[model samples]
Target chain A: MKISVQADAFDPGAELNAFSAGAAGAGAVVSFSGVVRDEGGRLSGISIEHYPAMTGKAIGAIAAEAVERWDLSDALVIHRHGDLAPGEVIMMVATAARHRAAAFAAAEFLMDYLKSRAPFWKKEYHADGAEWVAAKDSDEDALGRWAG
Target chain B: MKISVQADAFDPGAELNAFSAGAAGAGAVVSFSGVVRDEGGRLSGISIEHYPAMTGKAIGAIAAEAVERWDLSDALVIHRHGDLAPGEVIMMVATAARHRAAAFAAAEFLMDYLKSRAPFWKKEYHADGAEWVAAKDSDEDALGRWAG
Candidate 1:
């Protein structure tokens, strides 16, 4: 497994390919990229904040746990910090496994964990105003399924 | 929606770019690729046969239905025909939506529908022998949940 937190946008495909490298017996590789969107211009951009040390450790822990939970041949995770404009990719999660079930599940499972567990503050830039977007109660609710 | 049965491989990032084209409202785009695995060293290639007209129509129709079921903005379905060697990709499913849920669910649903409903025949070539591999009964079992 590999994890990186950076200020620059990264190629999710390349990251996924790197994860699946040397995985000859691997039958499936699944990945997800979280892109910054305008929300149809409902929101313009998002400024994310994080504590470098704790954030890195937290994310690493999540990736490690994911590796244990799934029969993954390999995995890659990349998440960006600092300011992100609309249409920029915010994060990516990729998994390679010997079967489709493990790959697909691990990819989604990681994203769900990231959205609800990763400690990052996102301030939404909106046409109306800018505000620190609190983690949604609904997002927390969604995370519950995985925790149990 | 774009549906094609090809002998060539595809780039997911490029296909994703096309899927999100002209759809500025798309906030999240999710994709999945199924590649050929090293089932055997002598597995030089395999020939994929499908009912061309019906397969394309079924996939398009399934994608259209998935868009409704998941409220997707756009979807693309591409699969291969003829001979495909190990390390070659077999199919790609991409979906764009206003949220991650719609994008993720729809892409998965499209895959389930294709695996069960599409009329595709696969013949495997190996050193020991050559055999025709039909879509499994368990694959049909897997699709049942989607209909419900």
Candidate 2:
């Protein structure tokens, strides 16, 4: 498993290709990417903040849990912080396994955690102003499904 | 939405990039890829045969169902037939939606259908001989999850 929290822009295509190449024994690969949405053009962009020291460790733990639970051959998580425009990829999670179900489930599990429990703080900037975006009940509910 | 049933090799990375570019206004994009696997080092490769006339139409219909059911912004399905070596990509499915849950569900639905119900027939080649690969009960069980 690999986890990265960086401010630099990344090419999902390139990253995905590299990840796939490294996962030699995996027959199934699943990837999920989160893009910034303009929301009817009212939003200009989004600004994300994170604790650099703790962010990678937190995400790594999440990825490790997913890898272990799913018996994944490999997994990757990449999150970008700072300003991001509409259509820009904010983060991505990928999982590789011997079967499609495990890969898909692991990727979704990572995404649910990222949306609800991860340490990233998000602020949406609009034409009028900017405001902090709170975690949605839906996100929390999604994460709850994995709980025992 | 786009669906292609081709015998030529494709770059999943390139297809994924193009699909993401076309799926604007989508907050979540999910992609799944199936690679040819050589189990126990006894396998050489695999040969896939498909009914060319009906393959595209069938997959397109499946993609349509997923788009409408998930309210997806866009969807893409690509399948390659003919002989494939280990580690080569055999098929891919991508779904774009306003939310991660919808995107993930739709992609998994497509994969389940492809594995069990698609028109493609697969034959696995080994050092001894070649054997036709039949659909597994697990694949049918996976598809059953989508039934109403």
Interface RMSD of each: 2.6, 1.2
What does candidate 2's lDDT look like per residue over A57-127, in tens digits?
Answer: 88988888999999998999999999999878899999999999899989999999887767899999999
Worst 10 residues of 1 chain B by lDDT: B15-24
For residues A18-130, write the lDDT of model 1, one tens digit per residue: 55544556767766777777776688789998888787788888888777888677777788988998877788777777767777777777888788777778899988889
TM-scores, all candidates, are 0.92, 0.98
Whole-model lDDT values for every prediction: 0.77, 0.89
Which ranges in model 1 have alpha carbons more than 4 Å from their true place? A17-23, B20-24, B40-42
- Report how far off residue B63 is in candidate 1 (Å): 0.5
Candidate 2: deviation at residue A38, Å?
2.0
Question: Each model's fnat?
Answer: 0.42, 0.64
What pairs collide in candidate 1? none
lDDT of 1 at B88: 75
Q: Over 4 Å off in model 2, which ranges?
A: none
Q: For model 2, which pairs clash?
A: none
Among these predicted structures, which one has the highest TM-score? Answer: 2
